[model samples]
Target: MYLSYEETKDIAYYMCDRTQRLTLPMLVNLLLDVSEKQSDSLERGEAYIRDRGLNWIILHYAFDIGRMPRLNERVYIETFATEYNKLFTYRTFIVRDSNRTELIKVETTFALLDSKKRKMARIPEDIVAPYKAEYSKRIRRNKKPDEVNSEEYNEKQYAVRYFDIDGNNHVNNSHYINWILDSLDSTFLLDHDITRGVITFNKEVSENQLVFSQSSIREEEGLNSDHIIKTEDTVHCSATFTWDKVKRRNMNGYDQ
Candidate 1:
């Protein structure tokens, strides 16, 4: 059986940027809410046992945006679990227009965390059995993002306001998206839209902690770069973003 969920999004805030299209952080928020409906997630059956006090943490995620939906555009997202292993479970999502035209695709890996112990937990079989585990994956699994050197990066700092923290007492993954993308100057962000990205979350940053967002340019592959988010000494997260003027594809793989 394929456990599925659906939602529609309308861009009503500055969240989309001057490009007038949905931003990556908004897309991430959409998927995160959608993820709760899965049988394997903390919000759903069997997995929802509260006394056990378990939650899910994203280890890594990647998405490909073939087209960015415009402001006031209502886009539909359909998501389902692809499969799961001992420690990691994979899910895929597709974004479509009202007429069913495909607009975007995303895949992510999640790990179960025992809240009390603060450690990774193995996924139970009952959780994996319900998904459409056909050994299919839309995108290849991504490794942890590289840690950038402190001296060789452009950086910005942000305060962890109350709203930025989630129930986990840390900056919500959705807000981290904004901090990373926002570090890029407007001229570059306006000229190029995100075609794909990979983010790996390492440590956790709690409320009142100062966040340092760091980035570096890689001009070789269309427009690509790496980013890191940390405090004064310890790292919290890292990611890589690849942008293009527009989607470029070949029969074998992505052209850019």
Candidate 2:
């Protein structure tokens, strides 16, 4: 089901810091929260599948940061299931602010997991039924394949720190975004605000693994530019992020 007007406002409000500009990590966390809530709602009145843990294993995620808006501005947003393949489920997001038409668009893939073994498992019938009912038209059957274009982007280096790994014992998906964002020059970051991003993870970076972060920029037709990231020998991930030279809201109080 789509979020109600008040529900959407509440989510949009929480998406930003006190200054009201949302960060990449904040948007990622918000997506996770909403997915978990939907999962819980589907599993209600049924025996919790202890083997299939509630947390989703993020295979890949992409965000299109559309525009930057001021704090206290009314923004409307919604997220819905888009597809379910043999092993992964896809979801999409759209956001818009008061003065503009569209602010952001995002799509992500997730897998139901056996948390302890770190393996894929089937989603329980009851749990999957509600989502299918609500989003059958949006669900596509195509499965995502693992592939990367290693020759296109230039490679850079990164030293993976201890904090990069999450409870699942591998590099957290959000950390990939951090590495990509860090690869951009500090001056660029300070001068412009990120308006959109599209990222896909090809492989996981484990603890202490020296990672090669690669990127390339292209002048696109729109107001934003295109970007990609890869490892030295392997293309770990690729993404496109757009930026606008606008007054950015201070988000120092927000969690990174």
Candidate 3:
């Protein structure tokens, strides 16, 4: 079964850049919100799973942008439970304009966490049943982010701010997008728009911790970066990012 929601990207929030369209982080945040809402409606949401002493966290995410909507433009986002394994829940999304043209499509993998035990856990059948999940794969399976262990890679450090933490006391995925994008040069950020991104979460980071976000221009592959959230020996979390040439819209932009 599929569930959906609709909203217009707020202009107020985009005063800087992407003022006419949803920024990468904003788009990601919206996707996560829609996913959570669908799970809640299916009785497999955060609170529901938390009650059972288990929770779900995104393990991998990949999305392709076709056309980004501009300010005040209405969008319809629909989400579906594609599949699940003993350890991961698979889901997908379709984002379109009011006229019904697809703007973006995304596939994500989420893993069950034993919140109390603080380790990995198998998903319970009850929750899986509610999503009507299957075993089929939709998009390409997410790969471990490519490594950029070269001396040429540029590194930037960030301080974990109070607002960056989510209810789970860990950094929100949207903020990770922010940090990853920030590693780029201002000229690159303004000139080339991101067409695709694949990120994987490795661990968790808490408040006040320092993180190192490293980037290397895969001039051949846009920008690639790895994020490390830590200050000590323990690596809280890391992510990989890949950017591509942006694709703009046409007269029949919503047709896709």
Candidate 4:
């Protein structure tokens, strides 16, 4: 049976936005941090994986949000690897308030890359055994987001910074969300809250590279945004964000 790891954290001011609610990028970072803590506790952290010439890579993320935690609010985060096939592993993360009301649920897919070959490698038993993740023959496929039509969307350029690279020698996954969200107009971002999101990373972006962030908004049925990140003509990432308009009176309470 697979086991779960959990931790408690308080939303700090640095993790909040102008509305004093937790930012999506920070929330994602925190969730991954809990998973890292668990790996360290099991003595299977970055060092162990590095010694084996393997590096973990995130392929996709899906998020469902009930509400964003407020600054200084305490919350519980729990994570566990549900199952793994030959190439991919599925993981789940849940965040809840002090009263145990769930705030968000994040489903992610990860894979291992052979450092020397720079290609995907099979899931080795030793690495996942510590987490007790169940083995499976089935490969889960998530719905892919629509591609961004550059001519129809707004685009912005960002230079890859030194801090964007992680231990995996690629841009940190969380920064992709930052670039996506930043592509939107500040007024639109401030007036809305992300209720759901789907993101997929297709290629890695290295430091000093210039990438374009593009976005197109839709509101006929409901508020939604499609985004893409690319360098020149090469697409690197794609994502979709569903949002809820914030009512000023209920902003603090996050009542929908």
Candidate 5:
């Protein structure tokens, strides 16, 4: 079994929303940061993979959030490589409050992309050996993100900023989540908190691309938001968010 790597972070002002809770996009970025730190510690970071003509690319993410970390609150985040198959690797992240209560649990899938060919590449044993992730032939099937229907949606267009591109020369994964959230109106965002989310990336968006973000809400057992991000030619990403009305107590907390 792979040993989990952990980190403690104090939620900074920039990472928090008006209500003093950590913003979802920054929360996702924090997960990525911890994962990168782990890889770098093991000498299996981005440079190592790129040297082998491959880059790690995220395919999907599923998040179960109990509550958002409040501003100035220190939380512990733990992550480990759960397992890997021929094509994809599965990882898990757990975020806990100072008292050790789990605030969020996340499962993510990642695959190797051949840098030159821009195609999915098979996982090599040598590459994953460092993580001690169990090798399995059986592929884990995660639920596909729900398709966005043809119904009217709130749409916004954004020009990919220079900072959005990572060293990999592609738009960073967390920005897609940001776009999805930004498509929603401020009122909706302020009143509701995302309790769960599923996001899947279909293609990569590059620098200077103008991407359209579209979102529509569905009222079922609870409030659900479906989102799509696409350029003129391709649908780059799609996601679904399940929300709960923000509690007054949370909204009244200290604003840092």
Candidate 6:
């Protein structure tokens, strides 16, 4: 079922901070919450699918954070079932302000797993049917970076300090944003406001892993510029972060 108006606003608030602009990781977390809530509401007791035994392990996730319009402006975020193949289920999100128009769009694919066995598991039929019913369109899967070619960007590398790893013993998904932002010079970050972003996680970086972060930019005549990140010896992930020349509010300490 589509999320309610009240639910959408609550999610937006959960994702944004004092500045009222949503961050990339916050947007991803909210989408996960929406999907879990929807699954729990299904007729059958299939909500356990939301829990991957311990915590939900992301197979693949990506999102776009649009520029904030104004203070105290109400924004809405909604997630809907997109499609499900044999082992993976796809979900999508759209964010907008009070008028119910879309500001940003996000898509992700997840696989059910037996975490202990580290093996793929079948998604319950009841849970799968609801998503299939909600979204009948074909699922368009995102491409994974080729393992061999992804390593060409290793010239830029950073040591993953102790604090960077989360309770899960892996780099926190949010920290990837911090690393990405850090890769840019202070002048560039200060000069631009992130208007939109698209990121795909190819592999998990473990604790104490000395990973490399690399980025490239291309400026078009009138289109927004593009940026990407890759690990040394492999392109662990790639993203296109677009920025608005006009600054809205100072982000200050809002990296998550």
RMSD of each: 6.1, 5.9, 4.7, 2.1, 1.9, 5.5
TM-score of every candidate:
0.83, 0.66, 0.83, 0.94, 0.95, 0.67
Residue 26, candidate 5: alpha-carbon lDDT: 94
Better of 2 and 5 by lDDT: 5
Off by over 4 Å in 2: 1-20, 44-50, 53-55, 69-78, 95-102, 113-124, 133-156, 222-232, 247-256
> Which residue pairs in candidate 3 collide?
102-256, 203-236
Q: Tens digits of per-residue lDDT for model 2 on 1-256?
A: 5432212443456555344566576666655555555656666321354434644567666666665444556655556675565566777767777654877777777666666666677655555556663433343432332222345554557788888776556676766776676666655565667765666666666667787665544455433433444445666666666667646434553223
| Higher-scoring candidate on lDDT, 1 or 2 | 1
Highest-TM-score candidate:
5
Better of 3 and 4 by lDDT: 4
Candidate 4 residues 1-256, lDDT tens each? 5689999999999998888899998998999899989999999898899899998888999999999999899999999999998999999999999999999999999999898998899988889888888889999988677666557898999999899888678888878889999999988988888998899988888788999999999774578899999998788899998899887735554443
Taken over the whole model, the C-alpha lDDT of each candidate is: 0.75, 0.59, 0.70, 0.89, 0.90, 0.57
Mind giving the per-residue lDDT tens digits that candidate 6 earns over 1-256?
Answer: 5433224544345555445555556656556566666666764223354353523346565555455434345667677766666666677777787887777777777666565675667665655675543443454567442222233332356767787775545566666766665666656665667765566666667666676666544454322333344555665565556665543445663423
The numbered model that scores best in lDDT is 5
The CA lDDT at 92 in model 4 is 96
Model 2 pairs in collision: 63-197, 65-195, 65-196
Off by over 4 Å in 4: 249-256
Winner on TM-score (2 vs 4): 4
- TM-score preference between candidates 1 and 2, better one: 1
Which order, best to worst by lDDT?
5, 4, 1, 3, 2, 6
**Candidate 1, superposed: residue stretches over 4 Å from native:** 38-49, 132-141, 144-152, 246-256
Q: Can you tell me which runs of candidate 5 are displaced by over 4 Å?
A: 249-256
Query: Candidate 1 clash total?
Result: 0
Q: What ranking emerges by TM-score with the best candidate at the front?
A: 5, 4, 1, 3, 6, 2
| Tens digit of per-residue lDDT, candidate 1, span 1-256 | 6667787766665656555677788878777766665553534553463345777788788877888777778888888887776788888889998788998998888777887888888766655565656543344467666555556777889988888977655478988888888888866776677777889888878888889899877766577878998898987889988887644434432233
